[model samples]
Target: MALIETRDLRRVYDLDAGRVVALDSVSLDIDKGDFVAVMGPSGSGKSTFMNLVGCLDKPTTGHYRLADTAVERLDADGLARLRNREIGFVFQQFNLLPRVDALGNVELPMVYAGFDRRTRRERALHALGRVGLAERAHHRPMQLSGGQQQRVAIARALVNGPSLLLADEPTGALDSRTANEIMALFQELNREGVTIVLVTHDAEVGRHAHRLIRFRDGRVTEDHRQVPVDARALAREAAE
Candidate 1:
């Protein structure tokens, strides 16, 4: 079954003088375990689509099924619960709590999910290890490099054991080297079968994904898959 399916999804904003259609009848299906990239120019409705998929906004019309549940039908509390359980988000900004250490920041979501102290610590540690940050777990955001801080944020997102990882320009604030490092980590996670959806306008950033879906004027403009990343190239890059 598809992990995400949408049909005629629309979001309309009513202004005093006019009605603006942010998303106009976009229909799509993203299979389970797919690494999909969403691309668009500014004002092209991609942000609106991301908001709906992330459960931050409801559709103005039509239907959306996420993991086989009708997202449009869920009440606010139901949506919140589902989001807490099934979605992990990484933003352009690292979004780490400056006052907390890396482990504490990673444990925040579990705290919201009602995990106990011991279990939260273990799971958060495992997540940090997965992102190659286990040794830096005690450092604060200010003490880490940009790449290290982003790794901590990625660990936090995964600590929830979410079914889907959604990232919006996760590399926007980083230097090319740091961004590539984060993308490599995401590629590794995708290989481990974590479904991922990333929103990016940069073609370089989107190239990391297995599939691409382009948006224009509130509709899907293109959808296609790319060749797998060359193993030798990846290894060579890793050695650099």
Candidate 2:
């Protein structure tokens, strides 16, 4: 079964002027271990789609199934639980706590999930190791470079072993070199059997994904599979 399946998804916002349709009957399926990138211009419903898929918001009407569970049938509490258990979110802003070190930041999710302190520490450290930031576990966000901080954010997102990674412009804040590094890390994670759906406006960033879905006027205008550019190779060439 597809890791994510949405059928006739629609979202509308009621304003004083009138109702504005943000997502207009969108439907798509993302399979397990797939790397899909969502691309669109402003107000094209990319963020709206991500929000619904990430469980941050619900669609006005549609059917959404994540790994065989009916998302549209879940209540608020159930959605929160499902989100915490199955979805990991990475945003443009690092969103790390200002006073928390890398380990603490990564452990926050496990803490919310009722993990014991010992297990939280172990898992957080393991996640940091996976992101190549184990040595910086004690470093605060302010102490790390932009790329390193993003690595910490990625580690935090993965600490819970979520079934899907939802990244919304995760590399937007980085320089080209740092952005490539982050994309390389994402590619590596996807290769290791993690499903990923990323929303990116940058064509260069989207090129790293195996599939691209472009939205326009609150609908999907294009969806196509492509040979992804090798982010790690680009990073290596930049270093050379």
The predictions' CA RMSDs to the true structure, in order, are: 5.4, 5.9
Clashing pairs in 2: none
lDDT of 2 by residue, 1-240 (tens): 578999999999999999999999999998777889999999999999999999988899998998778998899999988888899989899999989999999999898899999999999999999999999999999999999999999999998899899999999999999999999999999877778899999999999999999999899999999855346533443564
Task: Provide the TM-score for each candidate, comma-separated.
Answer: 0.92, 0.94
Q: Among these predicted structures, which one has the highest lDDT?
A: 2
lDDT of 1 by residue, 103-213 (tens): 999999999899999999999999999999999999999999989999999899898988899999999999999999999999889877788999999999998888999
Lowest-scoring 10 consecutive residues by lDDT in candidate 1? 228-237
What overall lDDT goes with each candidate model? 0.90, 0.91
Worst 10 residues of 2 by lDDT: 228-237
Tell how far residue 25 is off in model 2, in angstroms: 0.9
